[model samples]
Target: MARATVQDVAKTAGVSVGTVSRVLNGSAAVSASSKEKVTGAIRQLNYRPLASARDLRRDRTMRILALAKNLDSPIISEAFRGVGDAAALSGYVSLIAPTAGDLEREQQLVDILRNGSVDGLVMFSPTMPDDDIEALATQLSVVQVCEIADSEAAFGVSIDDRQAAFDITRHLIETGSRRLAMIGHRAARSGRLREEGFREATAKAALLPEQTLFADGDFDFHAGRRLTRELLKMDPLPDAVFCGSDTVAAGCVREITGAGFRVPEDIAVAGFDDSIQAEMCVPELTTIRQPAYEMGRLAFEALFERMTEPGASRRGRTFLPHELVVRDSTKGEAKA
Candidate 1:
């Protein structure tokens, strides 16, 4: 059978070819009734638009690049899945670029992305300075996920990491944990926010001073293990440890068990990002359930919106909710 074309769709829908084209391209200018008719005709005819022709008409590559600090991280993987799924639904190809938390590398990626390499970009945990991101926003439609850009011109989607950390720390304290320790990447913005939250909660509970032990490292399993070992040597070991990521938490759990300490009994461990590793842990991990997938999806949607409507107002910052998931790792609440 001959492939159905836009002309046939327009004829069947009793609309101009332009109207059909608008509908096919997801143009907001098309009316709802006309869109419904065009969609019905497309369904009846099984019409499939040619990508080359559409790209020619739109003057775009229909490609989006997502830059992640660490593509191997489970949270980042979930977010990437969301971005890829959303892009596929919209008939756009999605690509991933690992920045590995290198500012120079991210800047280089941005330079490449700005040379008409892709239609737009999505950044996860970008390490670039706010000024650089703000300047980049002027050149390309960019959306950040899991990290907030300081400029209002740059769009972002993230959970309130500071508040979530505070809540989890409060939970640990309420359950009788006085000496608290934190292990995570301290230089990163997300890590700083989490640490701030932990400090705020501990300070409020009068558990500050020498009671709080802090160790900074890259948010990884090895870092967690190494830091935990150092923490264990403290004059009075912390009874509770709050980790920056689930992977780190898993390492802490392993180290604690190897040291003959029981989770939530002798040393409570709480982690951020409720990734798959959280559930696979021996006693299950108490963690902050960051909506990684949703953040990714929303970030892409924000960028697509800008791409579709150039004159639209900038979407400043979108903050999603974070939940505390209590498991056997902590002695506090059973589940949240």
Candidate 2:
């Protein structure tokens, strides 16, 4: 049997070669009907384009790279799955590389990307400065997911962290939690936004500054355990504790339980990112559900758009909605 070709696709779709090209290149100019016809013909013929050849002709790599602090994070892993799935539909390959939270290493990777190793780059919870990201955007198609930078030149996709935190914290306040404390890392932008939300909710309740306490550290179980232990030692311990992530909350819960305190009876607990750890806790955690998969899909689409249409400006961020899930970890008047 003979192998299929672009010309064959055009012929089978009853479209011109240019129309097939436009569809393959993801051009917005291509009509929906035409795209459907071309895609159908492609499936019918089992046609697979020679990515390398096509890339060479167009000066593209037919690839996109995702950079992250680490691949072990459940949220980042989910987002990477979305990117990979979307890339498959678009005939592009997706690769995820860890930056290990090293700014110099991240810059080195970006420099390699600028040399045309990949068609575009997607950053997950990036640690790089906004100015550096903006500078990179001038040369490469860059999209930030999860923890977005404040750069007008770069495209981003994430849930509203501040608003999600505010909603969750407000839930605690409404449930008779007067003394609130938050445990979060001050390093990441998302953490800071979440902290701001916590503060905002505390202030709205007219709680004294001393009544609202905070402990800044990394987003890890150990940080939660250590900081929570310290918070418990304080006089008039917090009635409610809000952790940055489910992993942290797990540690907090364990520490509280170990100290002979009952959740929501002695102290209520809340967490973010409704991860698997949320459910594994003795008392399931009340947390905010971030749309990580959807964020990843949107991030890839944004990067693809920039790759195909360089002239279009896809500045700023696309925000996804978050859900507040109430569970046994927090003592609320009502469940949601």
Candidate 2: C-alpha lDDT: 0.87
lDDT (0 to 1) per candidate: 0.85, 0.87
Candidate 2 local Cα displacement, residue 48, angstroms: 19
**Residue lDDT tens for model 1, 3-104:** 665668889999987788678777899999999999999999998754433554377778898898877788888988888766765667899999888889
Candidate 1 total steric clashes? 0
TM-score of each: 0.83, 0.83
Candidate 2 C-alpha lDDT tens digits along 114-177: 8888888999978788898988887789999999999878899898999998999999999889
**Per-residue lDDT of 32 in model 1:** 94
Candidate 1 regions exceeding 4 Å error are 1-57
Give model 1's TM-score versus the native structure: 0.83
Global lDDT of model 1 = 0.85
